[model samples]
Target: CNAFSEIHGLTPCYTLNGSVLKDASDTISLDLCSCDFNADGYRLPTEAEWEYAARKTISGMQSGLTASGQVDKYGKEDTSIPEEEVSWSASNAHGSHKVGTAGSPFTEDAPPVAGSGNPNGMGLFDMSGNVCEFVWDWSGRYIESEPGERASGPEAGSERVSRGGSWSEYTPFIYAGDRYSYDPNECYNYLGFRFVRTVK
Candidate 1:
């Protein structure tokens, strides 16, 4: 990502006020950051950034936090929109699908389902479920950051943090705050990424 951003230096690969991330296709997440906030190029989002953005996907309306102030019989809340409408999960997807395509596993040639993918409330797509996204944090216990400070993760670790569940996951795994970790050197179909650049 840094290399890509560096290659596009000054003329950023993304536009701050446009559909900056709309055109992103396949991404390769490299394990390289104590969560760099001072870099001059694009980078992976911090875990906090990833979670906050994913949570905004529901905009609190379909979040099952509706004003009926109701809770399910299981003592849990439910997401209103069908899982298939917002994500391709174990219930709806047999394998990884093209990003931004909802309802079924998508192909490059398949036209996108209107209103199915996302604009969330944030105009971001596939934030809930697609592939689990790599974030710039080494696997370690959470450490709170003081106001105005960034939470740099561990100095080093055997694994890296990943957020947002994938098509292979069940509904619970799709929760915005859900997270998992994996060996940085290992590979899996469900592991993927999203890139970001701090707006100048």
Candidate 2:
């Protein structure tokens, strides 16, 4: 949509409108098809991809890893650092800020400007907080077994899964491992998404 282009200078021809396909919205239409790496376009990330990136360990970006070999599940896994330092929650922000603005005593009701909050081990910002991101999976229970390479969720479901807590939610809901779901056609002010593409 124009939001991505206006904010990040990247644009996709598709939007949420149901103009591309019959009897389905844009998100649902795209969800019906498997991702093609040869195609030059944006797509949503799978649930596994989102969590791995959120929990990954990058040398120079973040240090949430412990001696026990446990990586940070949330962006603020290190107890030594205050939660306000890495996340925007009720403790600091009563509402969303810009995208990446950093400071103490956050009282604004706006999302932070991008890349302003704590970057995760993958050097990606706002992986734990900001706005909950929608993934390309249907809502379902987790299976303990490995899902093979590039695993996705069930083929059909009533609700789509969203990960990461939003700016309007509390701290408990904003963890990297936390998940929620909503109707595919529903839209909220606190809801947003990120785009992913595979290299050929």
Candidate 3:
């Protein structure tokens, strides 16, 4: 909700005299401040910010380490069942039902439905299975870069970013770091967003 408001709250200021200046004087709810304001209010999370948050310890799927005897819902070694193998999707939902209607006990043959069960490694809920979230990057193709522990993104002025698969999306695309983009002016119910703020 905060994400939606931050982007929506700051409607561009237009005037009959053609004088235009981006306004940063107004304030909306901090809950709604999901964007990055130049120096004012709030805005959507940056691509780097979003990725880091999504993959961070508090709200992401912890990978790399061996499943190390961790057993999946099916009692298989965590390593035997990769993250990709245990994810959920729209088809898994059988349509779009309310969250948590499917109960738990996510099995290998029957993983939990989208929005109907637990979240991934991240503390965040409904990340992969709820609704697709709008990101701050531009619409364009992606090429996973190489060689860095953590990278920011194009040059800061290039590209937009949206992540998380929506209620209607398939399973393969629901990974936390999956991304998409669109024109800022474009609008759609299928496309909503969440915002973040840095207190420092």
Candidate 4:
């Protein structure tokens, strides 16, 4: 996570777009260097862990979905908040803000971002606003196809999970439970990520 590194003054280390998944049976000699992650017990966040931090709830997408399973802003619900309460959406943002920008829609007068409106019960900042965050899971297409109860992601390979919405879009739909996937090492100027540390 770049934010954590910036806050702690640690040099960020990562190989852009390395192997997707490494299993016990895989026999490939690739360079796995020490990025100083071991010192802090740092690593990528699991799907559940990442979702918890992003939405603070286990429900599903903040926007309601249609009968066809397509994500839309009809009858969506945020389990983190009241029956239907949302802080971030495409209509409220122009692009990713600096962080902690508060205003109904985060316009020019607002803090420049969303989450500042109020943090979820978990006290996690920017869970639904600002730049989207990434998870350790390999993009799982279906719930049944997932690895296991604690499945990190698709065991078959490399794609990472992306959550939350960007500040540039204008839709109140991409809330918790709404997930996307991207290449692990791939970095976008508008895309950044946060990490979670497991206590156990």
Best by TM-score: 1
Candidate 1 local distance difference test against the native: 0.60
In model 1, the Cα lDDT at residue 122 comes to 50
Better of 2 and 3 by TM-score: 2
Q: Could you tell me the TM-score of candidate 3? A: 0.50
Candidate 1 vs 3: which has more TM-score? 1
- Judged by whole-model lDDT over C-alpha atoms, candidate 3 comes out at 0.45
Report the C-alpha lDDT of model 3 over 127-172, residue by residue, as the tens digit.
4444556665545554466765233345333335666665564323
- The local distance difference test score of each candidate is 0.60, 0.58, 0.45, 0.48
Score every model by TM-score: 0.71, 0.68, 0.50, 0.56
List the candidate 2 regions with Cα displacement exceeding 4 Å.
1-33, 59-77, 101-113, 143-148, 170-172
* Per-residue C-alpha lDDT of model 4 across residues 5-121, encoded as one tens digit per residue: 446754443322542222313322212322233334345676676665544323453332211112223323424343112333355555666554433344466453434444443
Q: How many clashing residue pairs appear in each of the predictions shown?
A: 0, 13, 20, 13
* Candidate 4 similarity to native, TM-score: 0.56
Candidate 2 per-residue C-alpha lDDT over 26-132 given as tens digits, one digit per residue, 9 for 90 to 100:
56565564444333456677787787776666432232232111235553336465545555555455555555542333434554455555555566656655567
lDDT of 1 by residue, 61-179 (tens): 22422211112333234455466666666766766666766544456577566445533445566666667788878889998899988775775677889877777744227656677
Candidate 1 local lDDT, residue 199: 76
Q: How many pairs in model 2 have backbone atoms within 3 A of each other, for residues 3 or more apart or on separate chains, i.e. clashes?
A: 13
